[model samples]
Target: MAIAQSLTTTASLHYTPFIRELFDTLLTDSWCEVSSNRAIEFVEGEADVAVEKLVPYETRSEQGIFFTADDITMKIVNSLAAEVAVEKSFFDPSCGAGNLLLGIAKSYPIKKNLNRTIEYWSKKFGGCDLHDNFVIAAKLRLIALAAIRHGLPSISEGQLASFVRKFDKFYTGDYLEADVGGDFDCVVANPPFGHVVASRSNEWSSGRTQLAAIFVDKIISSGKKGQKLVAVLPDVLRSGSRYERWREKLAKETSCGAVELHGRFSKSVDVDVFILNLNNKPSVVGQIIEWVPPVTDTEGSVRLGDLFLVRVGPVVPHRLEEGDEDFPFLCAKNAPAFGVTFPEERIKFGGTKFLPPFVVVRRTSNPCDKNRLITTLVKGIEPVAVENHLVVMKPFKGGVNSCLKLIKALKDPKVTSRLNNVIRCRHLTTKSISSMVLQGV
Candidate 1:
């Protein structure tokens, strides 16, 4: 609510009366001239009163509602719009306040004639959301948009007011429970991401189901034949073990592609996310992903891939690998500076004696903290394996003699800082970690 009010206050100072009147008209159907001359003191006081009326919800629900910035929504819609013609109809089953719909509505050329713009806005989009308030908000925004299409400069109070209660742009109901009819050419959204809660208020709230999964299921099963869809979802959906079935379903069922987004929407959201485009007619043969490598230059740094016999953790239960035996399992927490910290709680999973000497580096760290290039030297006893979260760096067939000096070189502050600066997103990957430069360590 404070966010909404802050924006209003800014508009009051910089905007003309006509524009503020238009916005004030949206929030409270009262049409009046906006006054900026009432002094900053008056504006601040009024903004506080307006904020008090808002019914705010905590943003921490497992099923999140991180609204996408308008620019972000425009990009996703434009990407899908590029695939299919924009003149055709589109839908957002989870459209909240109609941002995506409004985004699409505004995508067409700004109208020199309000009638033409209204025609395009009316025909260019349609949507369905679960809440009445969102449906109403979506309509109000479109009306304001209709006023803009008429050219914001020429809008009269009566002319814009006439647009009110006129749009059948969206419906209010659970999108997953029913098909809110429309053979839309495309469906785009930033769907909810996370495990369901137990309020019995939402369909999957009581189960372990992820709401995002349910949204996808609905889009695929209910969409018209050949309908294309673009959505923003938690990155885990692209590769989590539990979601393997979901991937197989797509491989055998629809033509789908996913692109991971780089920087986060805001600092409050830490989870990495990806955009997915799916179609019934096999728009894509298989999955296509874009993974940008993290790279940097340091005085004495070298690519881990160049010297290490990199292997991911064996795909077996670490606990099940426990054969009532003590095996030196290299977990990330066990790395202690230049030496290895073999705590009593080590995972017991020594598969064979053929394992060779190797050094393990922590895979990820807090982005704000030191680029934790914490390396552990494993050489005194038989070589052990590491958890998947750790990158195993071993000598290439005949490249380097020992990982001892390599570990020491990696600990250099400049080396670690350079390596950290190369992060594509917020963490280090074995692929990225292995590609750093190194002095002849």
Candidate 2:
């Protein structure tokens, strides 16, 4: 008997009336593990319904629907397959419960018309997840889905285990350290969100780095010539900050395209996601495409690049003290302090020294709406010294004209709201200070 069948059969004998009812309710509906305090009450009601009906508990304990939002899954699969030819093999580095894998499998044939043969399509699909439970659950889900379509019983556990072993695939391990060897035709994944602090105790410590950025680096390193990749990333990278240098290098090393996804996909984690495609060829300069679903906006369309300018903030060396009048400074501490006064002291400008303008944006806010970029419209005014935590960006070409435009654009309620969640301020530079500025222009 199959493992699922055996587990179900054994469950029938041991399950109580209430437990049996709960099992039946789960089997019939979209229920997964309910841990929320409020959700627990609903589970109890469903359990009562099962008990009143005296239903036998025949559902398999391990079998439950992996909850990946269907809409996001569909978009990701469609977008990826649309970008690349179907004949190319696809891999998901962190394929959570194989939702993306299954979506790709379904869409590949219809979109590309390359998977007419069952064996051919199966060979093209590959995925890996660190969670053993998720891996097993995904294997079962895939086998079940395949069985329904192909008219066969679910694959036996032993057979499934063998399949994983034969491919040298599906071993449980951290994706960061996993050796995914060589380049794949296409790579897709929604890696874990948030920063992973590097400490002496951690095995994967490589200084302090955000987990999301590291995933991008890993994908680039794992990719081979002509390999294509799609990943969901936070909007933090768009700012031309120090992080941009890494992204710029990645872009140069592997030509890449980005598409941003707005709104919340997971109720548990609130983050804006962007889908990035990386290929071995040189990227077309100035090519940026932003896709925000119709639900996110009634305005019809929005481009990710148009909404904001992403750049690194100013960096103040330790030599500059807080009260020193030598330079104007905006440090992280000044943010939210209330009644903090700007120090007004001027120092002599020497060779290669220039005062750059900047705005202090608070880093923590929902949708990043609290952050504002400050630029002075007055010409020939040098920016005060910026302390750490304040980003300084001046017009690259247009002087006061550009600064005015940025300030006007950010003043919008919608844009300001988003800025507040991520940035404390955006600092603008004067025409005289920018590297690109011609002496008298």
Best by lDDT: 1
Tens digit of per-residue lDDT, candidate 2, span 36-155: 222333222332233224433332112211234456667777777654453667777776556666667654543122113334545566666655544443444443344334433234
Candidate 1 C-alpha lDDT tens digits along 216-299: 867877777777778877655553445556656665556655554534454556765666766764644565332223454567
**TM values, all candidates:** 0.63, 0.54
- Model 1, position 411: C-alpha lDDT score: 73
Q: Which regions of candidate 1 are displaced past 4 Å?
A: 1-60, 80-86, 109-120, 152-165, 197-209, 256-260, 283-334, 337-357, 363-374, 382-441
Best by TM-score: 1
Cα deviation of 387, candidate 1, in Å: 7.5
lDDT (CA) per prediction: 0.57, 0.46
> Could you give the C-alpha RMSD of every candidate to the true structure, in order shown?
8.6, 11.4
